[model samples]
Target: MKFILASASERRIELLSRVIKDFKVIPSDFDEQTIKFNGSVPEYVMKLSKAKAEAVSSATYAFSESDVTVIGCDTIVSIDNLILGKPKDKQDAFRMIKMLSGKVHSVYTGITIINVNFDIIKCDYACTKVKFSNLSNQDIEKYLCLEEYEDKAGAYGIQGYAGVFVEAIEGCFYNVVGLPLNKLNKMFGEMGINL
Candidate 1:
Protein backbone atom coordinates (compact mmCIF):
# COMPACT_ATOMS: atom_id res chain seq x y z
CA MET A 1 0.00 0.00 0.00
CA LYS A 2 1.08 3.58 -0.67
CA PHE A 3 0.61 6.54 1.64
CA ILE A 4 -0.23 10.10 0.66
CA LEU A 5 -0.65 13.29 2.59
CA ALA A 6 -3.28 15.67 1.32
CA SER A 7 -1.69 18.83 2.60
CA ALA A 8 1.27 21.07 1.88
CA SER A 9 1.93 22.25 5.43
CA GLU A 10 5.62 22.07 6.23
CA ARG A 11 4.92 21.56 9.94
CA ARG A 12 2.63 18.63 9.30
CA ILE A 13 5.04 17.12 6.81
CA GLU A 14 7.90 17.35 9.28
CA LEU A 15 5.82 15.93 12.13
CA LEU A 16 4.51 13.00 10.13
CA SER A 17 8.04 12.19 9.02
CA ARG A 18 8.77 11.18 12.60
CA VAL A 19 6.31 8.29 12.26
CA ILE A 20 6.12 7.45 8.61
CA LYS A 21 9.36 7.45 6.69
CA ASP A 22 7.95 7.35 3.19
CA PHE A 23 4.89 9.14 1.88
CA LYS A 24 3.86 11.36 -0.98
CA VAL A 25 2.64 14.90 -0.55
CA ILE A 26 -0.39 15.71 -2.64
CA PRO A 27 -1.92 19.02 -1.60
CA SER A 28 -5.69 19.07 -1.68
CA ASP A 29 -7.49 21.49 -3.96
CA PHE A 30 -10.57 21.70 -1.77
CA ASP A 31 -11.72 25.25 -1.10
CA GLU A 32 -12.33 25.61 2.63
CA GLN A 33 -14.35 28.81 2.16
CA THR A 34 -17.19 26.69 0.85
CA ILE A 35 -17.77 25.28 4.31
CA LYS A 36 -19.49 27.42 6.91
CA PHE A 37 -18.81 27.21 10.62
CA ASN A 38 -21.91 25.87 12.40
CA GLY A 39 -20.90 26.48 16.04
CA SER A 40 -19.00 23.19 16.46
CA VAL A 41 -15.29 23.70 16.00
CA PRO A 42 -14.40 20.04 16.14
CA GLU A 43 -17.02 19.06 13.61
CA TYR A 44 -16.10 21.96 11.41
CA VAL A 45 -12.47 20.94 11.24
CA MET A 46 -13.40 17.30 10.73
CA LYS A 47 -15.62 18.23 7.80
CA LEU A 48 -12.84 20.21 6.22
CA SER A 49 -10.33 17.43 6.76
CA LYS A 50 -12.66 14.87 5.26
CA ALA A 51 -13.31 17.04 2.22
CA LYS A 52 -9.59 17.45 1.70
CA ALA A 53 -8.92 13.72 1.99
CA GLU A 54 -11.76 12.87 -0.35
CA ALA A 55 -10.61 15.45 -2.83
CA VAL A 56 -7.15 13.92 -3.03
CA SER A 57 -8.32 10.34 -2.84
CA SER A 58 -10.81 10.73 -5.66
CA ALA A 59 -8.38 12.55 -7.86
CA THR A 60 -5.73 9.85 -7.57
CA TYR A 61 -7.76 6.65 -7.16
CA ALA A 62 -8.25 6.03 -10.83
CA PHE A 63 -4.57 6.33 -11.63
CA SER A 64 -3.16 3.99 -9.03
CA GLU A 65 -3.50 0.25 -9.29
CA SER A 66 -2.41 -0.40 -5.73
CA ASP A 67 -4.17 0.60 -2.57
CA VAL A 68 -3.47 4.13 -1.39
CA THR A 69 -4.17 5.75 1.95
CA VAL A 70 -4.66 9.49 1.97
CA ILE A 71 -4.33 11.54 5.11
CA GLY A 72 -5.78 15.02 5.44
CA CYS A 73 -5.70 17.47 8.32
CA ASP A 74 -6.96 20.95 9.26
CA THR A 75 -6.15 23.18 12.22
CA ILE A 76 -7.78 26.24 13.76
CA VAL A 77 -7.71 28.32 16.91
CA SER A 78 -10.92 29.16 18.73
CA ILE A 79 -11.59 31.62 21.48
CA ASP A 80 -15.02 32.26 22.92
CA ASN A 81 -16.42 29.99 20.25
CA LEU A 82 -15.00 32.22 17.55
CA ILE A 83 -12.79 30.60 14.93
CA LEU A 84 -9.53 32.25 13.93
CA GLY A 85 -8.26 31.11 10.58
CA LYS A 86 -5.42 32.43 8.45
CA PRO A 87 -5.25 36.20 8.48
CA LYS A 88 -6.30 38.07 5.36
CA ASP A 89 -3.72 40.78 5.91
CA LYS A 90 -1.32 42.30 8.41
CA GLN A 91 -3.98 44.19 10.35
CA ASP A 92 -6.13 41.10 10.58
CA ALA A 93 -3.14 39.17 11.86
CA PHE A 94 -2.46 41.79 14.49
CA ARG A 95 -6.08 41.76 15.59
CA MET A 96 -6.02 38.02 16.05
CA ILE A 97 -2.78 38.06 18.00
CA LYS A 98 -4.02 40.87 20.23
CA MET A 99 -7.19 38.96 21.04
CA LEU A 100 -5.17 35.92 22.06
CA SER A 101 -2.75 37.81 24.25
CA GLY A 102 -3.01 36.91 27.94
CA LYS A 103 -6.01 34.74 27.18
CA VAL A 104 -6.66 31.02 27.03
CA HIS A 105 -7.74 29.58 23.74
CA SER A 106 -8.33 26.18 22.19
CA VAL A 107 -6.32 24.82 19.29
CA TYR A 108 -8.11 22.18 17.28
CA THR A 109 -6.79 19.83 14.61
CA GLY A 110 -9.00 17.53 12.58
CA ILE A 111 -7.56 14.43 10.90
CA THR A 112 -9.04 12.25 8.20
CA ILE A 113 -7.72 9.03 6.68
CA ILE A 114 -9.20 7.48 3.58
CA ASN A 115 -8.37 4.23 1.83
CA VAL A 116 -10.29 4.38 -1.38
CA ASN A 117 -9.50 0.83 -2.46
CA PHE A 118 -10.66 -0.57 0.87
CA ASP A 119 -13.58 1.80 1.11
CA ILE A 120 -12.52 2.91 4.56
CA ILE A 121 -12.79 6.37 6.04
CA LYS A 122 -11.93 7.67 9.49
CA CYS A 123 -12.20 11.16 10.95
CA ASP A 124 -11.23 12.53 14.35
CA TYR A 125 -10.07 15.70 16.10
CA ALA A 126 -7.80 16.84 18.90
CA CYS A 127 -8.03 19.98 20.99
CA THR A 128 -5.44 21.65 23.19
CA LYS A 129 -5.95 24.50 25.61
CA VAL A 130 -3.26 27.14 25.24
CA LYS A 131 -2.68 30.12 27.48
CA PHE A 132 -0.83 33.11 26.15
CA SER A 133 1.21 35.51 28.20
CA ASN A 134 0.29 39.18 28.26
CA LEU A 135 1.67 40.88 25.21
CA SER A 136 2.23 44.58 24.80
CA ASN A 137 1.33 46.26 21.54
CA GLN A 138 5.07 46.64 20.94
CA ASP A 139 5.61 42.92 21.30
CA ILE A 140 2.79 42.19 18.89
CA GLU A 141 4.16 44.67 16.40
CA LYS A 142 7.63 43.19 16.64
CA TYR A 143 6.38 39.66 16.12
CA LEU A 144 4.22 40.67 13.19
CA CYS A 145 7.32 41.91 11.45
CA LEU A 146 8.63 38.35 11.27
CA GLU A 147 5.75 37.40 8.95
CA GLU A 148 5.37 34.06 10.68
CA TYR A 149 1.67 34.79 11.16
CA GLU A 150 0.88 34.97 7.48
CA ASP A 151 -0.31 31.42 6.81
CA LYS A 152 -0.86 30.29 10.37
CA ALA A 153 -4.14 30.12 12.21
CA GLY A 154 -4.70 32.55 15.04
CA ALA A 155 -2.00 34.67 13.47
CA TYR A 156 0.59 32.58 15.28
CA GLY A 157 2.61 29.44 14.95
CA ILE A 158 3.30 27.65 18.19
CA GLN A 159 6.37 26.09 16.63
CA GLY A 160 7.75 29.44 15.57
CA TYR A 161 8.42 32.71 17.36
CA ALA A 162 4.94 32.47 18.86
CA GLY A 163 6.23 29.71 21.09
CA VAL A 164 7.27 32.45 23.48
CA PHE A 165 3.70 33.63 23.67
CA VAL A 166 2.43 30.33 25.05
CA GLU A 167 2.60 30.31 28.81
CA ALA A 168 0.91 26.93 29.25
CA ILE A 169 -0.80 24.19 27.35
CA GLU A 170 -3.31 21.71 28.79
CA GLY A 171 -3.26 19.03 26.12
CA CYS A 172 -1.07 17.55 23.42
CA PHE A 173 1.71 19.94 22.46
CA TYR A 174 1.94 18.47 19.00
CA ASN A 175 -1.70 19.33 18.41
CA VAL A 176 -0.92 23.00 18.79
CA VAL A 177 1.78 22.64 16.14
CA GLY A 178 -0.84 21.25 13.75
CA LEU A 179 -0.89 17.40 13.79
CA PRO A 180 -1.49 15.28 16.89
CA LEU A 181 1.01 12.47 16.49
CA ASN A 182 -0.34 10.30 19.29
CA LYS A 183 -3.91 10.46 18.05
CA LEU A 184 -2.77 9.93 14.50
CA ASN A 185 -0.71 6.86 15.37
CA LYS A 186 -3.62 5.41 17.32
CA MET A 187 -5.98 6.05 14.46
CA PHE A 188 -3.68 4.24 12.06
CA GLY A 189 -3.33 1.37 14.54
CA GLU A 190 -7.10 1.10 14.81
CA MET A 191 -7.25 0.76 11.06
CA GLY A 192 -4.61 -2.00 11.14
CA ILE A 193 -2.13 0.13 9.23
CA ASN A 194 1.31 -0.28 10.71
CA LEU A 195 3.39 2.86 10.45
Candidate 2:
Protein backbone atom coordinates (compact mmCIF):
# COMPACT_ATOMS: atom_id res chain seq x y z
CA MET A 1 0.00 0.00 0.00
CA LYS A 2 1.09 3.54 -0.68
CA PHE A 3 0.85 6.33 1.91
CA ILE A 4 0.40 9.98 1.06
CA LEU A 5 0.24 13.08 3.17
CA ALA A 6 -1.96 15.91 2.03
CA SER A 7 -0.17 18.88 3.50
CA ALA A 8 2.87 21.01 2.85
CA SER A 9 3.61 21.65 6.52
CA GLU A 10 7.12 20.65 7.50
CA ARG A 11 5.92 19.98 11.02
CA ARG A 12 3.28 17.55 9.84
CA ILE A 13 5.82 15.82 7.64
CA GLU A 14 8.28 15.40 10.49
CA LEU A 15 5.64 14.24 12.92
CA LEU A 16 4.14 11.71 10.53
CA SER A 17 7.60 10.36 9.87
CA ARG A 18 7.66 9.09 13.44
CA VAL A 19 5.13 6.44 12.48
CA ILE A 20 5.14 5.94 8.75
CA LYS A 21 8.63 6.29 7.32
CA ASP A 22 7.76 6.10 3.66
CA PHE A 23 5.02 8.31 2.28
CA LYS A 24 4.48 10.86 -0.44
CA VAL A 25 4.02 14.48 0.47
CA ILE A 26 1.33 15.83 -1.83
CA PRO A 27 0.13 19.12 -0.49
CA SER A 28 -3.56 19.58 -1.05
CA ASP A 29 -4.91 22.34 -3.26
CA PHE A 30 -7.84 22.96 -0.95
CA ASP A 31 -8.10 26.58 0.04
CA GLU A 32 -8.72 27.00 3.75
CA GLN A 33 -10.48 30.35 3.26
CA THR A 34 -13.28 28.48 1.55
CA ILE A 35 -14.36 27.04 4.90
CA LYS A 36 -16.02 29.25 7.48
CA PHE A 37 -16.01 28.60 11.20
CA ASN A 38 -19.38 27.37 12.44
CA GLY A 39 -18.93 27.87 16.20
CA SER A 40 -17.52 24.37 16.76
CA VAL A 41 -13.78 24.22 16.48
CA PRO A 42 -13.60 20.45 16.15
CA GLU A 43 -16.14 20.32 13.35
CA TYR A 44 -14.46 23.17 11.55
CA VAL A 45 -11.06 21.53 11.61
CA MET A 46 -12.45 18.15 10.64
CA LYS A 47 -14.11 19.66 7.62
CA LEU A 48 -10.89 21.34 6.59
CA SER A 49 -8.94 18.11 6.97
CA LYS A 50 -11.50 16.16 4.99
CA ALA A 51 -11.43 18.71 2.20
CA LYS A 52 -7.66 18.50 2.08
CA ALA A 53 -7.67 14.73 1.93
CA GLU A 54 -10.35 14.66 -0.74
CA ALA A 55 -8.46 17.13 -2.84
CA VAL A 56 -5.33 14.98 -2.85
CA SER A 57 -7.18 11.67 -3.13
CA SER A 58 -9.01 12.73 -6.28
CA ALA A 59 -5.83 13.97 -7.87
CA THR A 60 -3.90 10.84 -6.96
CA TYR A 61 -6.68 8.54 -8.15
CA ALA A 62 -6.23 9.65 -11.72
CA PHE A 63 -2.53 8.73 -11.80
CA SER A 64 -2.15 5.69 -9.53
CA GLU A 65 -3.79 2.28 -9.46
CA SER A 66 -2.27 0.90 -6.26
CA ASP A 67 -4.07 0.95 -2.92
CA VAL A 68 -3.36 4.25 -1.21
CA THR A 69 -3.99 5.84 2.12
CA VAL A 70 -4.03 9.62 2.23
CA ILE A 71 -3.80 11.57 5.43
CA GLY A 72 -4.72 15.22 5.92
CA CYS A 73 -4.61 17.36 9.01
CA ASP A 74 -5.51 20.89 10.17
CA THR A 75 -4.84 22.63 13.47
CA ILE A 76 -6.04 25.83 15.14
CA VAL A 77 -5.75 27.50 18.50
CA SER A 78 -8.75 28.97 20.24
CA ILE A 79 -9.21 31.25 23.21
CA ASP A 80 -12.74 32.13 24.27
CA ASN A 81 -14.66 32.08 20.98
CA LEU A 82 -11.96 33.36 18.69
CA ILE A 83 -9.98 31.04 16.45
CA LEU A 84 -6.32 31.84 15.89
CA GLY A 85 -4.70 30.69 12.67
CA LYS A 86 -1.26 31.46 11.25
CA PRO A 87 -0.29 35.08 11.66
CA LYS A 88 -0.38 37.40 8.68
CA ASP A 89 2.59 39.52 9.82
CA LYS A 90 4.73 40.52 12.74
CA GLN A 91 1.98 42.64 14.19
CA ASP A 92 -0.51 39.85 13.78
CA ALA A 93 1.82 37.38 15.46
CA PHE A 94 2.29 39.75 18.40
CA ARG A 95 -1.45 40.21 18.67
CA MET A 96 -2.14 36.49 18.81
CA ILE A 97 0.54 35.84 21.39
CA LYS A 98 -0.64 38.80 23.43
CA MET A 99 -4.16 37.48 23.46
CA LEU A 100 -2.89 34.07 24.61
CA SER A 101 -0.68 35.44 27.34
CA GLY A 102 -1.38 34.10 30.79
CA LYS A 103 -4.38 32.30 29.41
CA VAL A 104 -5.40 28.73 28.80
CA HIS A 105 -6.25 28.02 25.20
CA SER A 106 -7.41 24.98 23.28
CA VAL A 107 -5.41 23.54 20.44
CA TYR A 108 -7.49 21.45 18.09
CA THR A 109 -6.05 19.21 15.40
CA GLY A 110 -8.34 17.44 13.00
CA ILE A 111 -7.08 14.38 11.13
CA THR A 112 -8.64 12.67 8.13
CA ILE A 113 -7.57 9.33 6.66
CA ILE A 114 -8.76 8.16 3.27
CA ASN A 115 -8.45 4.62 1.91
CA VAL A 116 -8.51 5.27 -1.81
CA ASN A 117 -9.02 1.69 -2.89
CA PHE A 118 -11.92 1.12 -0.56
CA ASP A 119 -13.25 4.66 -0.97
CA ILE A 120 -13.47 4.91 2.81
CA ILE A 121 -12.88 8.16 4.64
CA LYS A 122 -12.50 8.58 8.38
CA CYS A 123 -11.99 11.80 10.32
CA ASP A 124 -11.45 12.70 13.97
CA TYR A 125 -10.01 15.50 16.08
CA ALA A 126 -7.74 15.89 19.09
CA CYS A 127 -7.92 18.78 21.50
CA THR A 128 -5.13 19.71 23.86
CA LYS A 129 -5.42 22.35 26.53
CA VAL A 130 -2.39 24.59 26.61
CA LYS A 131 -1.68 27.17 29.27
CA PHE A 132 0.66 29.98 28.42
CA SER A 133 2.45 31.98 31.04
CA ASN A 134 2.06 35.74 31.03
CA LEU A 135 4.20 37.33 28.38
CA SER A 136 5.59 40.82 28.70
CA ASN A 137 6.26 42.95 25.68
CA GLN A 138 9.92 42.13 25.91
CA ASP A 139 9.28 38.42 25.84
CA ILE A 140 6.98 38.73 22.87
CA GLU A 141 9.48 40.92 21.08
CA LYS A 142 12.32 38.51 21.71
CA TYR A 143 10.22 35.60 20.48
CA LEU A 144 9.18 37.52 17.40
CA CYS A 145 12.83 38.04 16.57
CA LEU A 146 13.26 34.28 16.23
CA GLU A 147 10.55 34.35 13.53
CA GLU A 148 9.23 30.93 14.51
CA TYR A 149 5.66 32.07 14.11
CA GLU A 150 5.71 31.91 10.35
CA ASP A 151 3.47 29.20 8.88
CA LYS A 152 2.46 27.99 12.34
CA ALA A 153 -0.99 28.06 13.77
CA GLY A 154 -1.58 30.18 16.89
CA ALA A 155 1.41 32.20 15.81
CA TYR A 156 3.43 29.75 17.86
CA GLY A 157 4.79 26.22 17.75
CA ILE A 158 4.78 24.40 21.08
CA GLN A 159 7.68 22.25 20.03
CA GLY A 160 9.92 25.20 19.28
CA TYR A 161 11.05 28.33 21.15
CA ALA A 162 7.41 28.85 22.05
CA GLY A 163 7.77 25.85 24.34
CA VAL A 164 8.98 28.24 26.98
CA PHE A 165 5.71 30.11 26.84
CA VAL A 166 3.66 27.04 27.57
CA GLU A 167 3.23 26.26 31.25
CA ALA A 168 1.19 23.12 30.86
CA ILE A 169 -0.62 20.93 28.35
CA GLU A 170 -3.47 18.52 29.06
CA GLY A 171 -3.49 16.23 26.08
CA CYS A 172 -1.40 14.88 23.21
CA PHE A 173 1.73 16.95 22.68
CA TYR A 174 1.92 15.58 19.17
CA ASN A 175 -1.47 17.12 18.47
CA VAL A 176 -0.10 20.55 19.32
CA VAL A 177 2.81 19.77 17.04
CA GLY A 178 0.21 19.23 14.24
CA LEU A 179 -0.60 15.49 14.38
CA PRO A 180 -1.95 13.15 17.05
CA LEU A 181 -0.32 9.76 16.75
CA ASN A 182 -2.42 7.95 19.32
CA LYS A 183 -5.66 9.19 17.90
CA LEU A 184 -4.36 8.41 14.45
CA ASN A 185 -3.55 4.84 15.45
CA LYS A 186 -7.02 4.41 16.89
CA MET A 187 -8.60 5.73 13.71
CA PHE A 188 -6.58 3.33 11.64
CA GLY A 189 -7.55 0.50 13.94
CA GLU A 190 -11.20 1.34 13.30
CA MET A 191 -10.52 0.71 9.66
CA GLY A 192 -8.81 -2.62 10.48
CA ILE A 193 -5.42 -1.30 9.51
CA ASN A 194 -2.45 -1.21 11.83
CA LEU A 195 -0.29 1.89 11.79
Candidate 3:
Protein backbone atom coordinates (compact mmCIF):
# COMPACT_ATOMS: atom_id res chain seq x y z
CA MET A 1 0.00 0.00 0.00
CA LYS A 2 1.12 3.53 -0.68
CA PHE A 3 0.81 5.18 2.75
CA ILE A 4 0.28 8.91 3.05
CA LEU A 5 0.44 10.88 6.27
CA ALA A 6 -1.77 13.99 6.39
CA SER A 7 0.33 16.09 8.72
CA ALA A 8 3.69 17.85 8.95
CA SER A 9 4.15 17.24 12.66
CA GLU A 10 7.70 16.15 13.41
CA ARG A 11 6.51 14.26 16.45
CA ARG A 12 3.83 12.42 14.48
CA ILE A 13 6.33 11.63 11.77
CA GLU A 14 8.75 10.20 14.29
CA LEU A 15 6.08 8.10 16.03
CA LEU A 16 4.71 6.71 12.75
CA SER A 17 8.20 5.86 11.51
CA ARG A 18 8.39 3.24 14.22
CA VAL A 19 5.72 1.11 12.50
CA ILE A 20 5.67 2.19 8.88
CA LYS A 21 9.09 2.57 7.28
CA ASP A 22 8.08 4.19 3.98
CA PHE A 23 5.30 6.72 3.48
CA LYS A 24 4.57 10.04 1.85
CA VAL A 25 3.90 13.17 3.91
CA ILE A 26 1.12 15.27 2.41
CA PRO A 27 0.08 17.79 5.00
CA SER A 28 -3.65 18.41 5.25
CA ASP A 29 -4.80 21.92 4.46
CA PHE A 30 -8.12 21.61 6.27
CA ASP A 31 -8.87 24.61 8.47
CA GLU A 32 -9.76 23.19 11.88
CA GLN A 33 -11.61 26.19 13.30
CA THR A 34 -14.26 25.82 10.63
CA ILE A 35 -15.44 22.73 12.42
CA LYS A 36 -17.89 23.10 15.29
CA PHE A 37 -18.95 20.07 17.29
CA ASN A 38 -21.53 19.85 20.04
CA GLY A 39 -20.27 16.52 21.29
CA SER A 40 -17.45 15.59 23.61
CA VAL A 41 -13.78 16.31 22.98
CA PRO A 42 -13.26 12.79 21.60
CA GLU A 43 -16.04 13.34 19.11
CA TYR A 44 -14.62 16.69 18.13
CA VAL A 45 -11.20 15.19 17.55
CA MET A 46 -12.62 12.31 15.51
CA LYS A 47 -14.48 14.76 13.31
CA LEU A 48 -11.32 16.77 12.71
CA SER A 49 -9.29 13.70 11.90
CA LYS A 50 -11.91 12.39 9.52
CA ALA A 51 -12.16 15.75 7.85
CA LYS A 52 -8.41 15.90 7.40
CA ALA A 53 -8.26 12.40 5.92
CA GLU A 54 -11.20 13.04 3.62
CA ALA A 55 -9.82 16.37 2.49
CA VAL A 56 -6.47 14.90 1.48
CA SER A 57 -8.07 11.75 0.07
CA SER A 58 -10.47 13.64 -2.18
CA ALA A 59 -7.89 16.13 -3.39
CA THR A 60 -5.44 13.42 -4.46
CA TYR A 61 -8.02 10.93 -5.65
CA ALA A 62 -6.97 10.73 -9.28
CA PHE A 63 -3.28 10.55 -8.44
CA SER A 64 -3.41 7.66 -6.01
CA GLU A 65 -2.16 4.20 -6.94
CA SER A 66 -4.26 1.02 -6.65
CA ASP A 67 -3.52 0.49 -2.94
CA VAL A 68 -3.36 3.74 -1.04
CA THR A 69 -4.13 4.56 2.58
CA VAL A 70 -4.13 8.06 4.00
CA ILE A 71 -3.68 8.79 7.67
CA GLY A 72 -4.82 11.97 9.43
CA CYS A 73 -4.28 12.94 13.06
CA ASP A 74 -5.11 15.83 15.38
CA THR A 75 -4.13 16.50 18.99
CA ILE A 76 -5.62 18.81 21.59
CA VAL A 77 -4.88 19.67 25.22
CA SER A 78 -7.75 20.57 27.50
CA ILE A 79 -8.45 21.51 31.09
CA ASP A 80 -12.09 21.32 32.12
CA ASN A 81 -13.35 21.65 28.59
CA LEU A 82 -11.11 24.59 27.77
CA ILE A 83 -9.17 23.46 24.72
CA LEU A 84 -5.63 24.69 24.23
CA GLY A 85 -4.38 24.77 20.66
CA LYS A 86 -0.93 25.75 19.41
CA PRO A 87 0.25 29.01 20.90
CA LYS A 88 0.08 32.14 18.76
CA ASP A 89 3.23 33.87 20.03
CA LYS A 90 5.60 34.18 22.96
CA GLN A 91 3.00 35.63 25.28
CA ASP A 92 0.39 33.11 24.21
CA ALA A 93 2.78 30.25 24.81
CA PHE A 94 3.62 31.64 28.22
CA ARG A 95 -0.03 31.97 29.11
CA MET A 96 -0.80 28.39 28.15
CA ILE A 97 2.16 27.02 30.08
CA LYS A 98 1.29 29.03 33.15
CA MET A 99 -2.29 27.82 33.09
CA LEU A 100 -1.16 24.23 32.83
CA SER A 101 1.25 24.64 35.69
CA GLY A 102 0.35 22.68 38.82
CA LYS A 103 -2.68 21.09 37.21
CA VAL A 104 -3.54 17.98 35.25
CA HIS A 105 -4.79 18.30 31.74
CA SER A 106 -6.05 15.86 29.16
CA VAL A 107 -4.33 15.28 25.84
CA TYR A 108 -6.43 13.83 23.06
CA THR A 109 -5.08 12.52 19.78
CA GLY A 110 -7.50 11.56 17.02
CA ILE A 111 -6.45 9.23 14.21
CA THR A 112 -8.24 8.50 10.95
CA ILE A 113 -7.38 6.03 8.18
CA ILE A 114 -9.12 5.74 4.87
CA ASN A 115 -8.61 3.79 1.66
CA VAL A 116 -10.17 5.92 -1.06
CA ASN A 117 -10.20 3.17 -3.64
CA PHE A 118 -11.72 0.49 -1.44
CA ASP A 119 -14.12 2.61 0.65
CA ILE A 120 -12.42 1.51 3.87
CA ILE A 121 -12.40 3.96 6.75
CA LYS A 122 -11.64 4.09 10.45
CA CYS A 123 -11.59 6.80 13.11
CA ASP A 124 -10.60 6.73 16.77
CA TYR A 125 -8.97 8.72 19.54
CA ALA A 126 -6.74 8.33 22.60
CA CYS A 127 -6.66 10.49 25.68
CA THR A 128 -3.86 10.86 28.23
CA LYS A 129 -3.78 12.80 31.46
CA VAL A 130 -0.74 14.98 32.08
CA LYS A 131 0.11 16.81 35.24
CA PHE A 132 2.46 19.77 35.14
CA SER A 133 4.61 20.84 38.04
CA ASN A 134 4.04 24.14 39.83
CA LEU A 135 6.30 26.33 37.73
CA SER A 136 7.78 29.64 38.78
CA ASN A 137 8.03 32.58 36.43
CA GLN A 138 11.72 31.81 36.00
CA ASP A 139 10.97 28.20 35.22
CA ILE A 140 8.43 29.17 32.55
CA GLU A 141 10.76 31.72 31.03
CA LYS A 142 13.62 29.28 30.86
CA TYR A 143 11.51 26.65 29.11
CA LEU A 144 9.97 29.18 26.75
CA CYS A 145 13.48 30.14 25.65
CA LEU A 146 13.78 26.71 24.06
CA GLU A 147 11.04 27.83 21.66
CA GLU A 148 9.50 24.38 21.29
CA TYR A 149 5.99 25.53 22.18
CA GLU A 150 4.93 27.01 18.85
CA ASP A 151 3.66 23.79 17.31
CA LYS A 152 2.55 21.97 20.42
CA ALA A 153 -1.02 21.85 21.72
CA GLY A 154 -0.16 22.49 25.35
CA ALA A 155 2.66 24.91 24.76
CA TYR A 156 5.07 22.20 25.85
CA GLY A 157 6.64 19.14 24.36
CA ILE A 158 6.79 16.16 26.67
CA GLN A 159 9.71 14.75 24.74
CA GLY A 160 11.66 17.99 24.76
CA TYR A 161 13.01 20.19 27.58
CA ALA A 162 9.50 20.37 29.02
CA GLY A 163 9.83 16.75 30.02
CA VAL A 164 11.28 17.94 33.30
CA PHE A 165 8.12 19.92 34.03
CA VAL A 166 5.83 16.91 33.83
CA GLU A 167 4.89 15.83 37.32
CA ALA A 168 2.92 12.75 36.30
CA ILE A 169 1.09 11.20 33.37
CA GLU A 170 -1.65 8.64 33.02
CA GLY A 171 -2.46 6.53 29.96
CA CYS A 172 -0.35 6.48 26.79
CA PHE A 173 2.77 8.63 27.09
CA TYR A 174 3.04 8.93 23.31
CA ASN A 175 -0.36 10.65 23.18
CA VAL A 176 1.15 13.68 24.93
CA VAL A 177 3.99 13.73 22.41
CA GLY A 178 1.52 14.19 19.52
CA LEU A 179 0.51 10.89 17.95
CA PRO A 180 -0.36 7.79 19.91
CA LEU A 181 1.88 5.05 18.57
CA ASN A 182 -0.16 2.20 20.04
CA LYS A 183 -3.41 3.57 18.64
CA LEU A 184 -1.89 4.23 15.23
CA ASN A 185 -0.37 0.78 15.02
CA LYS A 186 -3.64 -0.81 16.04
CA MET A 187 -5.51 1.08 13.36
CA PHE A 188 -3.03 -0.10 10.72
CA GLY A 189 -3.37 -3.68 11.91
CA GLU A 190 -7.16 -3.56 11.80
CA MET A 191 -6.94 -2.33 8.22
CA GLY A 192 -5.10 -5.54 7.31
CA ILE A 193 -1.80 -3.75 6.90
CA ASN A 194 0.12 -6.06 9.23
CA LEU A 195 2.63 -3.40 10.15
Roughly what TM-score does model 3 have, to 2 decimal places? 0.96
What is the per-residue lDDT of model 2 for residues 1-195, given as tens digits with 9 covering 90 to 100?
A: 889999988988998898898999999999999999999899999999999999999999787669999999999999997999999999999999999999999999999999998999999999999999999999999999999999888999998999999999999999999999999999999999887
Which pairs clash (backbone N, Cα, C closer than 3 Å) in model 2? none
Off by over 4 Å in 3: 37-39
Per-residue lDDT over 1-195 for candidate 3, one digit per residue giving the tens place of the 0 to 100 score:
788899999888998898889998999999998998565899999999999999988877778477788999999998988888899998999999999999999999999999878989999999999999999999999989989887889788899999999999999999888888898888888888788
Q: Judging by lDDT against the true structure, name the best candidate.
A: 1
lDDT of model 3 at position 113: 96
| 1-195 per-residue lDDT for model 1 (tens digits) | 888999999999999999999899999999999999999999999999999999999988667657899999999999999999999999999999999999999999999999889989999999999999999999999999999999999999998999999999999999999999999999999999888
The Cα error of candidate 1 at residue 68, in Å, is 0.4
Residue 162, candidate 2: Cα error in Å is 0.7
Measure candidate 2: CA RMSD: 0.7
TM-score of each: 0.98, 0.98, 0.96
**Candidates 1 and 2, the one with greater lDDT:** 1
